[model samples]
Target: MKTSPYGAIAFRPDARRLTVSAPSGELTVWDTSDPSRPRPAGRLRTGRGIVAAAWNPSATDLLATVSNDGSGALWRLRDDSAPEGVARWAALPDRPRHVGWVAGGSWVFSMTGTGRTSVWDVGSGACVGRADLTGGRPVVGAHYRGSEVVAVTDSGWARLWRPGRRPSEWVRLTDRPVSACTWSSTMLVVGDLDGQAACFDAEFRPVHTLRVARERPRALACADDGRLVASAGDNQAVAVGRDGSVQWETYLRPPGAQSITIAGDLVALSAGRPRPTLLALATGAELAGGRS
Candidate 1:
């Protein structure tokens, strides 16, 4: 399959669909019905270039993307065909730093580099609420859990906030920049540029920390059961136990690791090389024949 320079890759909540967005404004959708082989399903051309994207939790065909052209677009993709211009539900102002759905796809949330976050009603296309992040740093990523949003800043801080409300909790994670973050059922895992990753419980208590490699840990994923965590960075990848013990470590031939996604015990790590390789989170064993 032909590939481009993608900024982020997102697998649907059900792991049935995959979306890859390039910085050149190309969006490719893949059908992952066969976990071992993902076939390109459709493509959407956006001249502005994508910065970040997220799939709606409850809707398979619905997703949101933030582009460098200072616009955020909500799209309804067709499973069988390429998306056209009309598939865009709405385009909002300012380039979003991160985007995700909230309230079971009832609303869309977008964060900006200026510490501004907005909530839009997905059905009505109305601005429902907005909040200012006082962390004084650009938000790199955010995950919606229950009624609160956990956001990681460029300055290595994680702050929790509710729409239209002030920040309720904040934690200083590291001095080095946070590269990526993932949230599981009971844990929040964050990777940093210093080649370190940390896990925290729901109440923001530190569980374990691991120094996985010498390179920046750019990609991170955790098991839903909170038993394992994995990180890939700078040509090195490792899975660590909940107690911070190394389960496995290997050198990646790729130049860098792009993203990590975990579903159940299966973890997908997308290296800079494009295709994502599947590994067992429990044992760090690469799942054979399941490269997407």
Candidate 2:
């Protein structure tokens, strides 16, 4: 039997663990403390194919996932036992595409493919807020911090929304459609179909731009110190510095990277393969057991 490609990948910085989800709803946690030889730590099954997932910023063992079945769930990882579900909600009209946590993990939010967002209180599992974007374009990427939510669309517009407030006017980021985006406390990075990555400040002001790939970037991750890592259709992973210079590049096998995350001194990259590859963040060198 053929294996399913990884649908989502998330990194827990504090624990040096990488979580990879398959379309079959299996979530595998890999211990990456020894980056040269990662081993599976644990697993959780959602019973529904997950589209995206995010780790809680304040709760180290908490995770949120959204599924193709129009449901969303929260899970808690236990050291002595298998991971278990904490809460779940389902029967929504739209398919959720992304999930995130905010307010120090007290609340969770999910964004659907149609630009509808629902915020839920983690304690009661009750939805506290809802926001919608009426434009025809689909949301390509989104990032949530505190109470602010930023979403980028295929129309090349990025907009900010908060609970109980109207979404801000569209801010154009590029002429080409955005493919992926990631943000840190200090900066927001957006990748476009034209293979360009644009950096912006917290207030959405343009900071810099760099051509990171020859084809549309499929995944991006940014470090707190302003280092940016990206994987694109060109089958190459490139790292860029804060000064807007290419730091290093590593070629990958065909069908390139699908998701990426920065885990301390390493980059955990997932192509459409069975396991994610670990690369040295500084030089983009593949570590042991990362050979495809």
| Per-residue alpha-carbon lDDT of candidate 1 for residues 107-145, written as tens digits (9 for 90 to 100) | 777777656677777777777777776445766668776
Q: TM-score per candidate, in order?
A: 0.82, 0.91
Number of residue pairs clashing in candidate 1, backbone atoms closer than 3 angstroms, sequence gap of 3 or more or interchain: 0
Q: How far is 183's C-alpha from truth in model 1 (Å)?
A: 1.3
Score each candidate by Cα lDDT. Answer: 0.67, 0.75
**Model 2 TM-score (2 dp):** 0.91
Whole-model alpha-carbon lDDT for candidate 1:
0.67
**lDDT by residue (tens digit), candidate 2, 1-292:** 0012685788875637778876567778887778888888887766367767788888878888877777888988755567788988862557777777777788888887668888888998877778885354688777775687777786778877777789889888877777777777688888887778888888778999878777787777887667664554557888878776788888888766777777578887776665778888878898843443
